[model samples]
Target: MLLNQLIKELITKMGDDELIIGHRNSEWTGLGPIMEEDIAFSSMAQDKIGHSWALYRILHEELGGEDPDQFAFMRSEKEFKCCHLTEMPIGSYDFSLMRHFLFDHAETVRYNSMLQSSFLPLQQLARKVRGELKYHTLHADAWIIQLCRAGEESYLKMQTALDNCFQLACGIFEAGPDDKLLADEKVYPGEEALYGQWIENIYPVLVKASLNVPERKEPVYGGRYGKHTAYLQPLLNEMGEVFRLNPEATW
Candidate 1:
C-alpha cells in the first residue's frame, strides 16, 4: 500500500482503539480502588476519550463523513484495530495498576514518536497528549509503591498482572508499513525503540517495588494490524448499546 494510505489506516485504527479503551476505562469512575485513584483514572480516561473524540472528528471532518462511532462501537471483532492489551478485563487494583503502568508507558513513547510527525495536526495532537499523561504516570508510580509496600499480596498480584499482561502490552507497539514510512521519513521513531525505552525506564520501578517483572516475551501481536482480543466484542456491545438503541437520539 502507498505510504499515505498506510498513514491514514494507522491513524484510523489507533483512533478506534483509543475510543473504545477510553470509554471502557471511564466506566470505572467512582468505582476505582480508592477515591484519589478513582478520580485520577477517570481523569486519564477522559483524556483518552477526549483524544479519541478529536481523532474521530478528524476522521469525520478532515477525512470525510465517516461513521466514527460505527467503526468504534459496531465493527466486527476482527475489524477492531485495538491491541490485546486494552481489551483485556480490568482486573483487581494491582492488576489495573499493572495495566496502567504498561499502557501509560507505551502511550508516553507513542506520543513522543508522534511529537515528531511531519503531519502538523498529528504532531500537534501528540505533543498535547504527551503533556497530559505526566500526572497519570506519577500517580501510577505512587500507587505501585504504596501497594507494594502495603503487603506481599499486593506486590505478588501486581507482579502477576505485570507478567500476564506485559506481552499484550508490548503488542501495542507492533508497527506496520505506515510505521516504517513514518520512521524513514523521520516523522516517528520505530515502535521497537519505544518499547525498549519503556523497559529501561519501567524496569527499575518494578524492581524497587520488589514486583517481579515478567520475562519479556515476543509480543502477542495484533494492534496495528486490527486483530483485537475476544474480550473486545462484549465491551463494544455495552458501548454501542445506547447508540444502537437510538441511533438518531440526541444525547
Candidate 2:
C-alpha cells in the first residue's frame, strides 16, 4: 500500500476501536456499581467517541475518506478494525474494570508514542489526546489498586479479571501489514515496539495492585484484518441503528 493509504488504514483502525469501545463504555451509563463510576464511564465514553470523531475527521479532511458519520455507521462488520477485546460484552464489574485498565493503558502508550509522528495531523492530535488519556489511566489505575487492596475477595476477583483479560488485552497490539513501513517513515512506532512499551507501562501498576500479569500468552489476533467475533456484528448493528434509520438526517 502507498504510504498515504497505510496512514489512512492506521487512522481508520484507531478510530474504529475508539468508537466501538466508547459505545461499550456508554453501556455502563446508569448501570455502574456506584454512582461515581456511572458518571466516570459515561464521561470516558464521550471522550473516546470524541477522539474517534477527531481521528475520522483527519481521515476525511486530510486523506480523502468519506464523511465520518457514513464511514463509521454505514460500514459492514467485516470492514471494522476494532479488536475483539473492544467487541466483547461488558461482562461483570470485575471484567469491565480490568478491561478498562488494560485498554486505557494501551491507548495511553500509543498516543504517547504518536507525540512525534511524522504525520503532522496525528502528532498534533496526540498532544491533545495525551492530556485526556492521563486522567483516564489515572482513574483506571486508582480503581484497580483500591479494589485489589480492599480485601481477599476483591483481590482475588481482580486477579482473575487480569488473567482473563491479559491475552485479549494483548490483542490490542495486533500487528499491521504496513507497520514496518510506517515505523521506518516515523509515522508512528510500530505495534511490536508499542506492545513492549505497554507491558512495561502496565507492569508496575499490576504489581502494585498485587495482580499477576499473565506471562507468555499468545495474543488473540485477526481484528486488524477484519476478522471479528460474533459479538461485533450485533454491536455494529446496535451502534448504527439510529444513523441507519436516517443517514441523511443531521444530528
Reference-based lDDT, residue 87, model 2: 90
| Model 2 C-alpha lDDT per residue in residues 1-251, reported as the tens digit of each score | 59999999889889988999999989999999999999999999999999999999999999999999999999998899988899989999999899999999999989999989999999999999888899999999999999999999999999999988889989999988779999999998999999999999999999999887898478889898899999999988898999998899985
Q: Which lDDT values do the candidates have, in the order given?
A: 0.74, 0.92
Q: Report RMSD for candidate 1.
A: 2.1
Candidate RMSDs in Å, in order, are 2.1, 0.9
User: What C-alpha lDDT, on a 0 to 100 scale, does residue 59 get in candidate 2?
Assistant: 95
What overall lDDT, based on C-alpha atoms, would model 2 receive against the true structure?
0.92
lDDT of 1 by residue, 1-251 (tens): 36556566767766766776687678778798678778888888888878777776666665563666655656666766777888877766666777887788777767777876876677888877776878777877888877888877776777777778888887877777556676787656777778888888788788788877776668888755666667788887888888888676665
What is the lDDT, from 0 to 100, of the residue 231 in candidate 1?
79
Best by TM-score: 2
